[model samples]
Target: MEKNVKQIVEQVIKDVEVKNPGQSEFHQTIEEVLTSLIPVLEKNPAYVDAKILDRLVEPERQIMFRVPWVDDKGEIQVNRGFRVQFNSAIGPYKGGLRFHPSVNLSIIKFLGFEQIFKNSLTGLPIGGGKGGSDFDPKGKSDNEIMKFCQSFMTELYRHIGPNVDVPAGDIGVGGREIGYLYGQYKRIRNANDQGVLTGKGLTYGGSLARTQATGFGIIYFVEEMLKEAGKTINGQTVVISGAGNVAIYAVKKAQELGAKVVAMCDSSGYIFDEDGIDLPLVQQIKEIERKRIKEYAVRKPSAKYFEGNKGIWTVKADVVIPCATQNEIDLNDAKIIVENGTFAVGEGANMPCTNEAEQYFLEKGILLAPSKAANAGGVATSALEMTQNSMRLSWSFEEVDEKLHGIMVNIFKNTRDAAKEYGFEGNYLVGANIAGFIKVADAMMAQGIV
Candidate 1:
């Protein structure tokens, strides 16, 4: 039986690889999830017989279009946009819209695929979908960004709605970008569908703490993990990658929990402060001024800035959190982190650690919190915003934050219980995969194959 299960897993992966050629990221994610499901498949032969894995690997619908907008120079700029409605068994499609130069079919599919399981883990009624464009917002004027967003939404508005498909923000997309997209969506649809989008400005229908949800959720989940292991965040030295929203708020929450966040990074480079990072100063530079992280070293003379971002992982610390983009931590980075005696790793970004790196961490007995479970705070809170929008009401910061914290705790418990049940006692990577997969798989099976 075990042999048959392993063969099925391998065969399915080979087929997916052939079909999804050149989509390395998508293939990587699929392989990781499938590898963890050997025990599940062995225990539940019905899933294999029904070909549920085959159906899950494929998206329900994939949309692609060209977005052409005018720049400030009176010239036209064209970019590609994509939306992969990966699954809808649980509910309508729900995910973020990323705006970066790296946006492509494979990346969108990978993100959407991950979202299916992540949303399932949240126990929210939202399904998984992701849409974005290769439109880089950096260095662009506000008017240029508005023009691009409007053009992007002119076509996207027809596909999404308050219930059909709701898009939030990710990567380069933030409150400002969400506002621009929502405005255009409203103009075209001629409806005040506040629930159609999330990450909105508070006055317009956004939820409080949505901005800090992901970061705070990471800390909350990590706290649960530490508690189960008879540990705590107090007095721990922490290093976080990416000075963006996720990283910034993770620093704040970790600090609030008595952890000293000594380092954080951006695309330009990393800043290391021996005396602990100044959260307010980081917010001023990254959020208010939108400047590079190197500015942090300039403002605080005691800190030093490195010329590259990857070096941030090599610094010695008790805890490591990668809140940056995908595949940021490779095997080499993993080796360095483990060598530095880091006791725990929490992924605040999607697939930040490659397969080999993740295995190494687990082998070293590092308490690993997978991204699907750790960084789910953002999407979970987005769902909360959707609820508020549906009810035509707003939640106070405390109200929303308390809900977010409870959700994170529940997610941690779910992941931990699933891991223990699957015989991978402390393997969160496997735990997260199995726990998230069971919910979606059961829903798909019950729905009778869409």
Candidate 2:
């Protein structure tokens, strides 16, 4: 059975690689998930017989279009847009819309593929999908950003609905962008289907605490991990990458839990402050002013700024959370982190650690939180937002937060139990993959080959 599973996984991957040439990110994600499913296939031969893995890798729908809009300079700007509805076995497709220059089909597919397991672990009714464009919002005026979003949604709005696919904010997409997209969606549809979108402004139908859900959720999962190891986040020195919504809020929650976040970064550079990161200052620089992280050092003379983003991993800390992009931490960074006596790593971003880096952490018996389970808070809360939208009611901040915390705790338990049952205890990568895969696979099987 083990041999059969191995052959099956290899064959599927080989086929995928041939079909998806140059999509390294997508191939990496599929390899990671398939590697963890061997134990699962050994136990449940039905999944293999049904060729579920084959179906799982293929997206249900892939939409690619050109987004053309006028910039502040009155020039015609065009960008590539994509939406990969990876899976809808459990429920309607749901994910975020990222707007960055790095957004490509491979990146979108990778995110959408990860979203399948991540959404499954959330215990929400939401399925998996991801949409984004190579439209970089940085340095764009508000009017320009709004126009671009409007044009992007003009086509996207046709495929998504309250009961179909719901898109939210990610990376360059935020409240302002969501508002523009949602406005366009509403205008085109000629109806108030607020549930068609997740992240929205409060004046409309956005959920409270949704903005902070992913960051807060990462901390909650980390807390559960610490508890299992007879440790706590309290008094821990933490280093987090990215100064975006996820990193900022993760820093806030970690600090509230008695952890001092020493360093954070942007695309240009990183800032390290031994006195602990100033949350307000970071918010002002990254959120309000939309400036680089080096401005953080300028504001606080005590904080030191580094020119390179990768060097932030070299800082000595007990915990490291990569809220940045995929493969941000490679094997070298992983070794440096391990050598610095880092005890734990919680990935707040999807596939933040390379395969080698992840293996090194697991081999050293470090507590590693896989992104599928650890960073599921955002989508989980988005599902909650969907529920509220459908019922025409809103949940209080405390109520939504309480539910988010409970879901994160349950996700940890699910991953732990799955790992132990599969004889891979403490291997969260395998645990999360198997746990999330089982849910989606079961649902897919029940629905038949669709």
Candidate 3:
């Protein structure tokens, strides 16, 4: 980057930090993405002249609301809700609604900002936005959960529509939450607006294979990367963090691909089964029983459960997929994986690896699949769901799976080619950021300043 351009970019970043105080996650992502785009800014002064980065860093709209609901105990409960419509240059706002207690403006902004590029890479007509509440669904009763969802939707419905913004599930949000929220949306609008949300129950408007999209998509992206390296998933030892929907299905797909998944985890802890994780047992424990990962050890004596989420990175493996959450893997975790000779790390969770960890993987020459490109399966399929809803037709599981496979394969090739084009050959972090950014940038430029 030229000295003058560098100063300009630095000033923009400085302005962001000064304006959005205490938003560490948002600040981290902004620094990581804009720094990677320095080459692009240098090569094309139009983006700088138009102040693309300045406009991009600031969300088009940010909604914060207080959600008050009655619990099963007839007690009033309150939580904060947020919806960050980060960008919509190409299409409608597309992203997920998280329900974790950890959700905040910074986290939502980070996810939404990353979604701008992720959706662009899909080659689908969807932009980026995210919304959710800081309501933990862990121990809540079904009725209580429904009450919370209904109350959250009462305020959110005004800001969303099929062609405006569509939200899906993430973290503490899932089928049950989607169902409740969708029901409330229907009640408020007095009309069926199925496309207004994704991840709905199959009996409603949800697309087939929607549940498996992210996990399966991660493997599909990884498979292409491995093939480029003249390797395959077969006979590889895999350790995945998180035993949620993403991790469990990733285990299923990887096992089907002939890889031995040795470990999986939850917020509480992780379990290691060297002989290979029994997919059925894990599915039963997590999906059906909704139990902690520690139960895997008790049920299967061969496996061992270890407390703490970070320790999962220590176990040696050929591949490591972080399906847990943002910043799950830091520089130290990257060191452990690189030292252990783990060659590839695919992210199933959004921004699962910190900037330092991602840089370490790149420095070590590991085949790293960044989250925006790798985990785009979920949102891509959500777009498919939107299509199904619009057309009033449902495709079979096999059809959706095949289309998803094709999309993931294309994402890998696009990311790779973008890296080669920008003199950052094989650097997917840069490649993904650049590839995802260019499409949106062009669209934004065409649309003019909004």
Candidate 4:
């Protein structure tokens, strides 16, 4: 990187850090993305002249509100809600609504910042934004969950619309939650706006393949990466973290491609089945029964249960996909996986790896598929759902799945091509950041400073 360009990037990082104090997550993402833009800034002086990075780092709008609702116990409960409309240069604000106890402005900003690039990679007409509440949905009754969703949408609906901002599911938000939120949005607006949210139930406006989009998308992207390295998923050992929607479907797809997924996990612990994980049983425990993954071991004699989620990385495998939360794989986990001869890692969650861990894998020549490029299928399909709603037509599952596969394949090619074009061939993290950045940056530049 040239000295001038490097200095400009450093200054932007310092400004974001100072402005957003105590927001370690937001600072981390800003540092990562801005640092990667050095090469671009050196070659293209127009971006810096326009002060694009300064405008990009700050969101157009940030909404924070208090959500009050009645619990099943007849007690009044309060939670904080957030919606960061980061950028909408290309299209409307499009991202997921994550409901977890860990959500804060920093986390939401990080996710929203990353979404700008992720949505761009999908080749869909959508921009970046993200929202969620710091409410823990665990152990909440169905009525309680509905109450919280209703209270959340009461404020959120004012800021969001079908063509303005569309919110989908992430973390604790899913079909049930989306249904309730949509119901409340309908009641408040007195309009049938199916396009206001994605990930809805089949009888409603949800797309058919939306449920498995992220997991399947990751596999599709990984498959292309492996093929470029003269490899395939056949007869490979795989270990995945998380037993939620992303992990479960990722296991199913990898198994279908002839890979033996040996282990999977929930927040509590992981279950390992040497022969191969039983996807049906995992789905039952996680989806239907909503039990811990340890139940898999109790039900299947061959499977063994571990006490911690991080221990699953110890198992040797050809591929390791972290479908869990951010920074789940630290430097130690990366060292262990690299030492165990893991060939590649495809991220199924947002920023699932720490900076040091990602660096270690890249140093060891591991094939890495960054989350922005790999896990874009969900949002891409959500865009497809938005299209169906606008057209008032729905497609079959196979049709949606085919479209998703094509999008993932194209994302891989574009990222790979961008890396090669910039003399950073095989550095997918840089490639993804650059490829996604260029598109959004071009759009930002075309539009006058806003």
Query: Tens digits of per-residue lDDT for model 1 on 132-234?
Result: 9999999999999999999999999988998899999999999999999999998988889999999999989999999999999999999899999999999
lDDT of 2 by residue, 1-450 (tens): 788799999999999999999999999999988988998999999999999999999999999999999987889999999999999999999999999898999999999999999999998888899999999888888999999999999999989998999998898999999999999988998999999998888789999999999999999999999999999999999999999999999999999999999999998999999999999999998899888999989989999999989999999999999999999999999999999999999999989999889999999989999999999999999999999999989989999999999999999999999999999998888999999999999999999868
**Model 4 off-target regions past 4 Å?**
none
The per-model lDDT (C-alpha) reads 0.94, 0.95, 0.93, 0.94
Please provide TM-scores, in order, for all candidate models, with all chains considered together: 0.99, 0.99, 0.99, 0.99
Over 1-450, each residue of candidate 3 has an lDDT whose tens digit, in order, gives 488788988899899999999999999999998888888888889999999999999999999999999998889999999999999999999999999889999999999999999999999999999988899999999999999999999999999999999999999999999999999999999999999999999999999999999999999999998999999999999999999999988988999999999988898988999899998998899999998989999999989999998899999999999999999999998999999989999999999999999998998899998998999999999999999999999999999999999999999999999889889998888899999999999999999989
Distance from true position, residue 95, model 1, in Å? 0.8
lDDT of 4 at 323: 97
TM-score, prediction 3: 0.99
Name the runs in model 3 displaced over 4 angstroms. Answer: none
Candidate 2 residue pairs in clash (backbone atoms < 3 Å): none
Better structure of 2 and 3 per lDDT: 2
lDDT of 1 at 65: 98
Candidate 1 lDDT trough over 10 residues, lowest sum: 441-450
After aligning candidate 3 to the native by TM-score, how far in Å is the CA of 276 from where it should be?
0.1
Estimate the overall C-alpha local distance difference test score of candidate 2: 0.95
